[model samples]
Target: MKHFGGNDRDDDVRLKLVETLYNQPTSLMMAVLTGAMGGITAAIATQNPVITAVGVALALTGIVRFVLYYRMHRNALDHDARKLERIFEAGAYAFAGLCGLLAALTIYLHPPGAIQVLTVSLSLVYGVGISARNAARPLIATGQLLLVCLPIAIAGLLAQDIVYAILSALLVLVFAAVVSVTLNLFRILRDQITAAEVSARMADNMRRLARTDVVTGLLNRAGLNHDLVELLMALPEERMLAMFWLDLDKFKEVNDTLGHPVGDRVLAEVAARLRAQAPDKAAVARFGGDEFIVVAEVGDRFESERLARAIAEDISRSIRIDQRRIDIATSMGVALLPNDGHDIDTLMQSADLALYHAKVGGRNQVCFFDTAMTRDLVRRKEIEVELRSAIQRDELSIFFQPIVDLETGRIRSFEALVRWFHPEKGELRPDEFIPVAEETGAIITLGNWITAQAAKACAQWPEDVTLAVNLSPMQLRAPGAALGILTALRDAGLAPHRLELEVTESLFLDDSADTVRFIDELSAEGVRFALDDFGTGYSSLHYVNKYPFKKIKVDRSFVSGPNAGRKSDAIIRAVAGMGSTLDMDIVAEGLETIEQVQAVKAAGCTLGQGYYFSRAVPDYLAAMLLAQERERDEKARRA
Candidate 1:
């Protein structure tokens, strides 16, 4: 079977052929009047009863043929394509036969003077009509010319008189002239038709390109806009339209880690699946990067929900690209027309809010638009504004929680945590505002401030006491990250060895090469790096060995609670044992209870931090705690 793409050449030929048939009526009517006049003139010039009677009969015959030709042309529109072509072919043959008959009669009757001249003139004029009218269908034009002129020329060649011989040569010349002119005219017509087809094709291609997403082969934002408007305009009184806004979860992670070519394949597969899953009447488009929109007509909310669910199931299926199988999930936001919104822009905004809620509610599910979700966005906006001003107004402050040495009961290090002292809302933890900061790109500014403050505080601490600061994934992946950290150390007059940068496994998933390389640079410069919140993300034995890190912090999730506590103990033991062989120090974080501290110590943890030591406090209080510890150590040494 042939591919589904259209063929333009065939269409051009067909259009021109039909046009040739359509043009015949106007030219055919002219031929009738001229032929009748020529017959009358021949009769008058001859002045013979037999000649007049024959001329009158021929005129009447011409009139009959004229009526037939006119009827065929008029009825062409009512006929099917094949039948119309057949009608045009019959008309051409009939006209050509009439011309030949007139020529033969003129020659055989030997009409006198002006009558013979008029008969010959009729044949020449009809030759022009054949060439003009049938140029588009050159075969028809050629056959008609042969019928009109060839018979007359052959008959003239059989005559004995010199004048008759000259007339025959003239007739032959007329045939050649018609043939040559019609052939060239046909070529021009074919070229013009081809040009027109090309022009039309180019216009269609331009529109397709403008409205298509090149990567996914789906409709782009412009196409979506056009389709949405069309959907709105054509809406029925009872029917409702639903819009599904689907965004791929962790798509950037795939692109950043796997390269754009792999990312492009993923996007294409996504579009193909979405299109395949969508209903025939649905209009699917690529609304944003790794985001798709489906606007489908539905009878009710149940139908809309079913469609969204099916789309989600289809999109979530695994895709294999470049011999690597990747599983990606889509979070969909649905909004129904006339219920959620009436216009395209309003529906899109409503859908976006729903999508936001879906992401917030934990991805890999669908959410419908509701008025209540507006408050969540409003709070987000408020947080965004306050976060931007957090550092400038000195609303941001760092608190230090000590990482205690398990063997010596000494403060080994302090992890600096940022607390937003909101004048109205009191103290806010990283959980409440960190995501917003990262989303708003305010984390970089805030992180930089925290790093500087942490470095300055660690500088005042005892030489053995290092400070660990959790580095946001945003800060780690951004440009100038290494320089920013080094600048912070220099400005704070702190040694690189006195500060440890704590990074989560999330950073590795984002851009492993860049993140690993940046950490390598800092580690080479005598700065320490540790995997923070270890086992909470995509942690692996391979990753632990590949990266140059001095310490691993066991995430709190495995360290506390019921049966989780036993599992945490087992996990802690396994990690500490593995860390020992790798020459890595293990720090058990979020140790709240004395039992938690004892459990980590029994598990061979070298360091521990949580409420067991002290909750994170201001720099002055943390300094005093360290001072008290240092003074106690000195007195014990003196004793």
Candidate 2:
């Protein structure tokens, strides 16, 4: 087994043995008292001058041994442990040798009497004490035991009596047994220490792994919480901490388009960049997925803002992996301590709210939390709750705006727009609540209802006219979404060819093989798709060519804005030309005047839809308009 000191087993065992030997001051103190008392008693009992001098020498050796033990104990950590152990060994040997010499002198000078018995008994007692107390160093304990016992046994043997011979032989046997027992005790103590050290090291490693992120090797959410609590508690009163909540925009698109392995590499690179850009005192952590947090102490709001922006810029740079360049951006939200919040939970919530606003305002920017954002969050929550029951209350309705043919001036289709007539707020447009529904997963149900309603209403109109309904990205990507739309058309008795589904370019950002298969299935059933708000999103041209779109609608910004000069007209003409070449219809939206209508017609648009023709109306009004168109067509045919 490995040792915690990173040394061989024998070396570690030796170090531990030395440490154990010096730790017991009580044993050393007892040895000192025994030596002094023995010497005093021997000098008093034996009236020989040589015996008295030997006794004085023994007492001095005991004093020296006690002094060494005191120094080792006091400087145990600061001094070389091995050197201290050697010094201790020298002192023990000197004391044991002096005790033996004093006993030998007593046995020779005096006859079989009280003084001789007392000195020999004290020497044997010293042998027993070293065996137990110094067992950690077996060699040292054995040396001391033999030194104290052998002299008395030899002196007794030299007395030339059978009683002394028997006593000397018994002393040899006792010392042998003590040595064997001390060696066994040393082995057991060594094994126990080794096991304890291994267990402690393993536990420390497990704790470290538990708090680390496997993908990025950064502190995980649990680690962040653990460290953040300590940091907050120890925060200086003169300082303020800023919590930056960062989210990578379009990171899901990278995961969906490329694979998760590539996404992981990207995340790792992002983590490295964050570490490099963060302040020296900042604590960076990964909150799983594409979310990361950085907490740093700052002087004021301006410093925090500067750091957030700098980090965002660094993370937004293009990352190259596997010979492919992947570009991504990050949005950050900042919340300050003592102002935005005083605790971790409150600060995190405030920063997250600011992050939501950053994403909404447009990604790749930094936003700070304020009381107004909290109020807006409450309002959004209210909308989410009310919208859940809006359909059950029958408060939702569809309005149809006619799509007219530029050449024939005839209604070709009516695009269905959903409106919510809130009981207290009256009419609310799609923009006000559609985003909330999409976020809360209410769009799936809302889109299905609109599709079925629009299809049913179209079934009663002229056969040549088609119905167009918008599709949310969420609905299109939902499981079995194609089957649901087909079921709606069949139940309404509306032909699939008369249903046109309008989708935005944003739908393709997170496009997957399953979504493509679903679109193909619906297309096979004769449901046509139109690219809505084209040229307003990334990779519009790529999506237009990739998917089987039957129509492409020019974004309203290019139709009648003050900026719509030669450049806008050229773009419209170019799109119109491409659509004609591809055998697809081109529609120009948001025309509000005759001049705009004329401009699109001249630009070769096939269909037009805007307030210039008619605003979105109820089903009854739409039906009346269709009936009037049929009458005019009959009159023109007769002429």
**Against the correct fold, how does model 2 do in TM-score?**
0.62
For residue 531, what is the lDDT in candidate 1? 89
What is the Cα-based lDDT of residue 199 in candidate 2? 78
Candidate 1, 444-534: lDDT as tens digits: 9889999999999889988988989888888987888999999999999999988898888877775668887788889888898898888
Runs of candidate 1 with Cα error greater than 4 angstroms are 1-11, 40-83, 154-160, 202-211, 222-237, 317-325, 373-437, 440-480, 483-639
> Highest lDDT, which number?
2
Please give, for residues 1-639, the per-residue lDDT of candidate 2 as tens digits: 221232426555566667888888888888878887888788877767887887888888888888878887877777665686788888888888878878887876764488787888888888877887888777788888889888888887897878878888998898999988887777777678777777767998888888889999888998889878887987899999899999999898898889999999999999999899888867889998899999988988999988888898888888999899999899888899989997889898888888877876777889999887867675665677799899999999999999999999999999999999999979877987899889867899999999999999999998999999999989987778999999999999999999999999888887788769978999999999999998786745778778899999998889977688799999999999999999999999999999999999999999999999999999999999999999998999999
